[model samples]
Target chain A: MTLTLEKSPLTEAAYYILLSLYEPMHGYGIMQNVKVMSSGRVNLGPGTLYGAISSLLEKGWIISAGESDSRKKEYQITEFGKKAVDCEIHRLEELLANGKKITGAKQ
Target chain B: MKHSTWRWISDYEKEEKWLNEMAAKGMSLYGFFMGKYTFEETEPGKYIYQIELLENFPTSPESVAYLRFLEDTGVICVASVFRWVYLRKEAASGPFELYTDIDSKIKRLSTMKNLWFTFVWLEFIIAAANLAMVIYGWLVVGQMAWFNLGCVVFLVILGLILLNFGLKPARKIKSLKREQLICE
Candidate 1:
C-alpha cells in the first residue's frame, strides 16, 4: 500500500526500529540491526528495546510472527507499519534535497 | 474481607524467612515491613528508615549500614510494620483501614524523609533563602555583599541540586521493598 507523506511522526529510534523489522526479526536481531545501521551511534539497552517492542505491538505497527525456541520471539511489521516507513522515507528524502539545495546555494 | 495483623522483625534475613513460611502456609499477604529511627535534634537531626519487601528484600552493604545506624542511635524502633495481610481466598477483598499507633503528626514527619518529598522541600527552601539573602544584601550591605551572597547562593543551590539528583539511586532500595510485596 502506498502511504502519503503527511502522517509520519515518530522518534528516530522508533523509526529505525520499524525500518529494521522489514523482514521477520527477533528482539536481538532488531537490536543488532540498529547498531549496525547507526554504526554503533545508537546502542539500545535491553530494557529500552523491550519497551519499544511493547509500544510498537500496542500500536499495531508490529506483530509476533513466530517464536524461535521458547526464548526468542520473532516479529514482523504490518502493512500499516510499511506505509509509515514509506512516509518517513519520503519525508527524509525531501529534507535531504532541501538541505543539499541550501548548502549548494551557500557555495 | 478478613485481615490479620502481626509483628515480624524488620531485618532482611528474618523477614525473608517469615515471608517464605507464610507463603508455604498458603497465605496471601501484602504490606510493607518498615524500621524507623529518629535522631536527636542535632546538626544532622533526621530520621533514618528502611522498608523491606517481606518476600524479596535486599541484603546489601547499604541496607546493613542503615540498619546499623538505627541500632546505634538508640532511637525508638518500630518493626513489623505491616498494615494488612490476607489469606489466599480473601485476596480480592476491598481495602481495609490500617492505622499506625504512633502520633499522626510524627508519622507525617516520617513521610517527609522520603527522597522525593525531601528533594522538593530542599529545593524550595534553598531557593527561598537565597532570594531573601539577595534582596537583603542589595538593600543593606552593598554590591560587594551582594556579589558575595550571590556566590554563596549559587554554590548552595548547585550543591542542593546535585544532592537531590544523587538521591535517585537510593530510591532503588525502595523498589526492592515493593517487589517483595507484589504478589506474582
Candidate 2:
C-alpha cells in the first residue's frame, strides 16, 4: 500500500525563520534578522528561540556552529535542511502552476 | 483514676543518680542505663517502666556502687528490667499519603503552568526565527535561493512537531510533573 503523506500549513513566523538562517547566525542575530525580514511581524524571545533551536537540532535540520559566547550557541542548517527547503519550493511551484492552469482554464 | 507521671531531669547528674539507685535494688540496670527507659504513672502511687534498649550499658563496680547508694536511700524498684530491640518501623503509608495529597496537588499546578509556558515559548521562538529568515533571505541572501528554501522547510517541520506535542493530551505530562514535584 502507498503511504499517504500529509503536508501542514507553515505559520508565517516559522516560514520566515528558516529563511533567515542562510548564513551562520546566532540567536540574537537570528532574532534581529527575522524582525527586519517580516517588517516587524515576528519578534523572537530568547526562551522561544532556544526551544526552536533545540527542536531543529534534534531533527538534524540544523547543526551547531562555533559558540558566540559561553552561554550563547550558534547554529547553521545542514544538507538535509537544504534538501527540505528544495522540496518545499518544488511543492510550492507545483501548487502555483496548478493554480495558474485552473484559473487560466476558467478564463 | 488516670494519673500523669512527668519527671523533669534538668540536671544530667541527678537523673544518673536516680537511675543508679534503681539499678542497685535488683533492677536489671540494662533498660535504664541504655537510654531505653519509659515511665508512665498508670496509678497515683505506681509508675510503669517500659524501657527499650538502644545500646549496651557499661557494667562496672563504679556503676554498681552508685546503684547501691541510691537503693539505700529508699527509692522503690517496681519492675524487672527486660532487654528489647527498639524496632523503629516507619509508617509505610506516611510518605505515600504526603505524595498523593500535598505533593501531587502542588506538582500538578506548577507542572501544568511550566509545560504551558514552555509550549508557548517554543512557538514564539520558532515563529520569530522564521520571520528573521524571511527578512534576511529577501535582503542579504537573495541569490542563495537553495539555502533559504531549506531553512523554511526545516522550520515548518519543527513548527508542526511543536504544535502537535503542545496540543497532545497532557495526562502523562501531568503525572510526570506530579512525580517531580513530590520528589522535590
Candidate 3:
C-alpha cells in the first residue's frame, strides 16, 4: 500500500499509543506503558489520550479488546495500525538518515 | 454550605473560568439548572473544572459512553444542563482539560457553535413570525397592536442575543483553525 507521511503522520501520542497496544491494555495501563516507553518524556493526559483513542478507533486502526475491569476498557492495535506504525518508522528513519548526512554526524 | 448563584453566561470560556475561580475560592459546583448554580463550600483550590459543550446529553448513547470513558479516566462529572457538562477533577490531578489538542478544542468549540447557530435560526424564525402577527394585528385585527408590537420587539432582542452568543464560539473556532494551520 502506498503510504505518505503527510497523509498519515502519527502524532507523538498516537505513535506511543500504538506501541503500547502491541499487547491488549486498558486505558490506565496504556498510559503507564507510554510513559515508560517514552522515558518520561511524554505524559499522556487523560483528555489527550482519550482523543487519540477515539480517532484511532474511528480510523479502524485499533479495536476494543473488551473490559479489563469494572471500570476500564481494553484495546489492541489492529493489523491496520501495525502497518501504519511500520510506515511511520520508515518515515522517521529516512528523516534521521537525511539529517545525519547533512549535519556530518559521522564524518 | 450550599449556596445558589444565578448567572447568565453564553461563552464557554468565561463560564469555565468562572467555575474554576469559584472552586479556587472554596466553592465547588454541585449542579446547574436554568440560570442557577448550586455550589458547595470546600477546601480552597481543591478542584479544577472543565466545561464540555455536548450536542446531546443523558439521552444519546454516544454521549453516555463518552461520559463513561471520561469517568474511567478519573474525571468526575458534576452536572449537566441541556447540552452543557460541568466536569471537575482534583487540583492535584495534573490538569482538568477535556480537549488537549487544537483539533479537539476546535471540535469542542464547533459543537458549541452548532448549538448556538440552531438557537440563532430558531430565534430568527420566532422573531419573523411575531413580526407577521404584529403586522396582522395592526392592519386587519385593529386591536392590541401595541401589545403585539412589544412581543415582536422582545423576540427580535432575543434573536440578537442568541446571534451574539453564536459569534463567540465562531470566533474561537476560527482562531483554533489558524493555530492548527500554523502548527502544521
Candidate 4:
C-alpha cells in the first residue's frame, strides 16, 4: 500500500488514535491507551476522537471490528492504516535524524 | 429540589461556559429544552458540562452510537434538544473535553452553523415576505398596512440577530483554518 505524509501530517490526535488501535478497541479504550502511550501528556476529548474515528473510517484506514453484544463498538486498523503509521514514523525519524546530524550529535 | 432557568444564548461555546459556571456555582444542569435549563443542586464543581451539535437528530443511529461511545468513556449523555446533546462528567474524571484538535473544532463549528442555517434563512425569508406584504398593503391594499410593517420590523431584527450568530462560527472557522495552515 502506498502511503504519503507529504501534504499534511496527521493531527496529533489521529496519530495517537491509530497507534492505540493496533488491537480491536473501542473509543474509551483508545482514549486510555493514547493517554498512557503519550506518558499522560495527551488527553483526547470525546468530540475530537469521534471526529477522528469518522474521518479515519471514511479514508478506509480503519474498520469497525464487528460490534460485540456489548454496546461499545470496537475498531481495528487495516493494512492501509499500518502503512500510514509506518509512513508517519518514517517522516518523524527523518526529522529527528536531520536535527541530530545538523547539531553534530552524530559523531 | 430542581430549579429551572431560562437562557437564549446563541453561541454554543458561551452556552457551555454558562453551564460550567452554573456547575461551579453548585447548581448542575440536568436537562435542557427549548431555552429553559433545569438544574439540581450539587457540590460546587461536582461536574463538568459539555454541549455539542450533532450532525443529525440525537435519536438517529449515528448519534446514538456516538453517545454510547462517549458513555463508555465516562461521559454521560444527560439530555438532548433536537440535534444538541448535553454531556456531563464527574469533575473527578481527568480533563473532560469534547474536541481536542483544531480540525475537529472547526468541524464542530461547521456543524453548528449547519444546524441553524436553515432557521436563520427562514427568518430572513419570513422577514422579506412581511416586507413585501408591507409594501403591497401600503400601495395596493391600503388596509392594516401598519400591522405588516410591525411584522416586518420584528422579523427583520430577529433575522439580523440570528444571522450574526451564524456568522460568528464562520469567522471562527476561517481563523482556525489559518492557524492550521501555519501549524502545517
Looking at candidate 2 chain B, the ten consecutive residues that score lowest on lDDT are: B89-98
* Candidate 1: clashing pairs of residues: B53-B177
lDDT of 3 by residue, A16-78 (tens): 999999999987787779878878777776766887988888888889998886747899998
Q: Summarize candidate 4's per-residue lDDT along A1-107 as a digit string, tens digits.
A: 23333445777998998998899998888988998999988889888898899888888888899765676789999888888888888889998989989888656
Residues B1-34, model 4: lDDT tens digits: 8999898987778889989999999999998888
Worst 10 residues of 3 chain A by lDDT: A1-10
Ranking by TM-score: 4, 3, 1, 2
Cα lDDT of candidate 3 equals 0.81
Candidate models: Cα lDDT each: 0.51, 0.48, 0.81, 0.85
lDDT (tens digit, per residue) of candidate 2 on A29-51: 78678878878766653333544
Sorted by lDDT (best first), the order is 4, 3, 1, 2
In candidate 4, which residue pairs get closer than 3 Å at backbone N, Cα or C atoms, i.e. clash? A47-B98
- Give the residue spans of candidate 2 off by over 4 A: A1-11, A69-71, A99-107, B1-184
lDDT at position B148, candidate 1:
47
Error of 4 at B1 (Å): 4.1
lDDT of 1: 0.51
Query: How many residue pairs clash in model 3?
Result: 0
| Candidate 2 docking DockQ | 0.01
User: What value does the lDDT take at residue B150 in candidate 3?
Assistant: 79
Stretches of candidate 1 off by over 4 Å are: A1-8, B1-184
Q: What's the number of clashes in each of the models?
A: 1, 16, 0, 1
User: What's the CA error at residue A68 for candidate 3, in Å?
Assistant: 1.5
